[model samples]
Target: MKTGIIGAMHEEILLLKKDIQRLKTEQFGSREFHSGTIDGKEVVMALSGWGKVAAASTATTLINHYQVDQLVFIGLAGSIQAQLHIGDIVVANQLIQHDVDLSRLEHFPEVKSPFWKDFSFKVLPQSEDKALQAVETFLANLKKGDYPAISKEYAPQVHLGAIGTGDQFIASKDGKMRINERFPQILCTEMEGAAIAQVGADYQIPCTVIRVISDKADEQAHDAFAEFLFENISNISVEIAKLIL
Candidate 1:
């Protein structure tokens, strides 16, 4: 089966590209596609850049142009829950757009657009059971020698839960705490997963997100992100690709 992989930043995609043998390059609507293989699994991959629109457009291209059967979004996220630390993995069971707000019309919390009323979108209707199971299975069965490149004593902890996606980078402690309080079910927050999830749902294609916790919601987050992400992202990507493929 053909699988499409998308990363939100150039740094996230660079290592994966190094391992893959680039077979061809194609362009669709100003976006470039790189066809390749990862761990002997035939795949097409690209960096979707930073936010919702870019992610959605890339997902659409992966489905319509690349003709991939499944899509996997692998990247980093900020830990919303206090217990989660840098390097933990979060497999999204559901995705929420924290920025999607329309509480002005004497109504309960629900999605709304300026032009439309009561329009809401729910991501991952079934809670991504198969993908979550795969992640759990992989984590449970991983061997120390399986990946020597990563120095962590144990395989990363994989939590199956809600992942909030929005356009803003979650660098503020107050904002992070507020979101956690409002959406107690959420474990992590990132920029692109939900948008891609929405597009995948629209096209009826299976999609899953695997996010590595890069920082906790605190002042240390800003200080530690660059070094933490550079060291962990590639390793995280390899593990997620193994589970998905």
Candidate 2:
């Protein structure tokens, strides 16, 4: 099976690009596509940049242009739940667009505005229990020693829960607290996961988002990102590859 991997930032895609051997590069809609093998599995990958529009367009292109059977969005997110710390991994069991509103429509009560009456979004069901179990099992066996080139402990604690997506970058403590109070079950917040999920659902392709916590919704988020990203991003990418490949 051919799998497509999408990451929204250069940092998230760097390791995957480096790991690609026998790569063939192509472009469609100004986006670069790298097709290659990782762990003997056929893969096509791209960095979709930030935000909902960018993510949705890239996902569509991946499906139409590359003909991938499945997609995995891997990246970093800020923790909305206070207990979630940096380096923890979150596999979105479901995703929501906290910013979408269209309450005026009776049939789509989830939305809250007349303008958004025709803007209902899509949702990808959580991958089957066996797939999730396999991911968790691989994460459990990941070790820092296994990746000698990488520094810091590569321990990952996986949380399966709601992940909220929006176009805005979440760095405020007050905003984080407010969102947490409103969606208490949400585990993380990011800019692109839900958008990708919507496109995957439209195409009837299985999709899953695996994110590593790079911040905890505070000023320290900026201070900690460089360290957290450098130490854990590649390890997380490798873990995702192992699970699917």
Candidate 3:
């Protein structure tokens, strides 16, 4: 079975690409896709860019051109829940496009943007199981000193919950409050997961979304974001990929 692994940035997928044996690279939709075996598992990896449209297009291309049977997306997200701090991992059980609003339409006043039934996608059970297992394994390795500690006092915790997706990068306190009020169960906010999930749903390909908390969705969200990406997120992603693959 071929698995299509997607990340929204180069740092997220760089180490996984290096792990691929007998790698082959190709370009499609202005994105580079690398195909090879990781731990005897056939996989295709790519950067899906940074928004719903880009993610959907890349996912569609992977499903259509590469014939990937399943999809996995890993990236950094701004935490919406106060309990979730940076370095914590969130395995998305469901995802919603929080920015979608059809509630204003005269005929569709009953359709509530994020609350609408069609606006959400549930992760496939089997795929979620695999992802959870991989995360648990990674955490175990961390405890065994195979990976670096998340912090002096904090061991990264895994949370399974709803993740909100949208085009906007939530950076202000008001933005976080609005989304939290709208979707209280949402653990984190990011740009791409739900869109790819929608495409996966369309093609009947199972999808799994795993995100690492990079910043709190607040006024200071962008501060040190780039440093966090390079210093921490990439290595965590590599460990997860190793277990998942």
Candidate 4:
């Protein structure tokens, strides 16, 4: 069972590539893909680049070229929920492109587009049952311990809920508030999860999205993200990868 693990940034993909024993590399679409074994499981990992289109294209390539049986996206996201804070982890149960509004986008005439032909602004579904079960097991079976990058006071929590995606980074207060009102159950917001989910839906590929909270989706998000860009972000992601994959 070959798994395709994707990340949007170098930090997100580097450790996994390093962890792969007897790794081999191949370049595709200007991105390098590393293939090897992870915890005795055959896997291919790559940096999918940023945004919805890049993620979708990467997913398609992994499916077609690597023929990966399952897909996993591990990265950081901005927390939009009131209770969530830094170092918190979120296993996406659902994903939606909050920026997608077929009604509003379809009305544009000058710069014509066809991608929104029959699409709707609804929750993009993902095949995540087994992945969700694995996460539940991980949380339930955990022993008392402190996470390295996580603060003891915050006592990092695990959230399972919807993840919103869009090209624009959620920073301004109004941007964060609007998304919150649109998707009340959102656990976090990111740039690529929904697009990856959409490609999975097309190929019937099972997908699991895991995001660590890096900042609150507000005016200070960009600054906070810079201050808190944990160097070991890939560590938590790989830990979850081992358990789920």
* Best model per TM-score: 3
Off by over 4 Å in 2: 104-131
Residue pairs of candidate 3 with colliding backbone atoms? none
Q: Which of the numbered candidates is closest to the native, going by highest lDDT?
A: 3
lDDT of candidate 4 at residue 46, scale 0 to 100: 85
**Quality of model 4 by C-alpha lDDT:** 0.78
Report the C-alpha displacement of residue 86, candidate 1, in angstroms: 1.2
TM-score of each: 0.85, 0.86, 0.93, 0.84
- For model 2, residues 1-245, the per-residue Cα lDDT tens digits are 88888888777865677777799998887789999988788899988998999999989998998888887788889998877888887877787776675544577657565333333233344463534665677655555244555454556577878888888777789878877776787888898988887777778887777778998867677777777777668666665665665
Which should have the higher TM-score, number 2 or number 3? 3
lDDT of 3 at 13: 70
lDDT of 1 by residue, 1-245 (tens): 78888998876764666667757777777667788876677898877889999999999999998889888888888999987888788877777877776556556556445453422234454436666776676566455356666665645777878889888888888989888877888898888988887887778887788888888856777766787777767766766565677
**How many clashing residue pairs appear in each of the predictions shown?**
0, 8, 0, 1
TM-score, structure 4 vs. true: 0.84
Stretches of candidate 4 off by over 4 Å are: 104-129, 133-154
Error of model 4, residue 184, in angstroms: 2.2
TM-score of 1: 0.85
Taking every candidate in turn, the Cα RMSD to the unseen true structure, in Å, is: 3.4, 3.4, 2.9, 3.7
**What is the Cα root-mean-square deviation between model 1 and the actual structure?**
3.4
> Positional deviation of 205 in candidate 2, in angstroms?
1.1
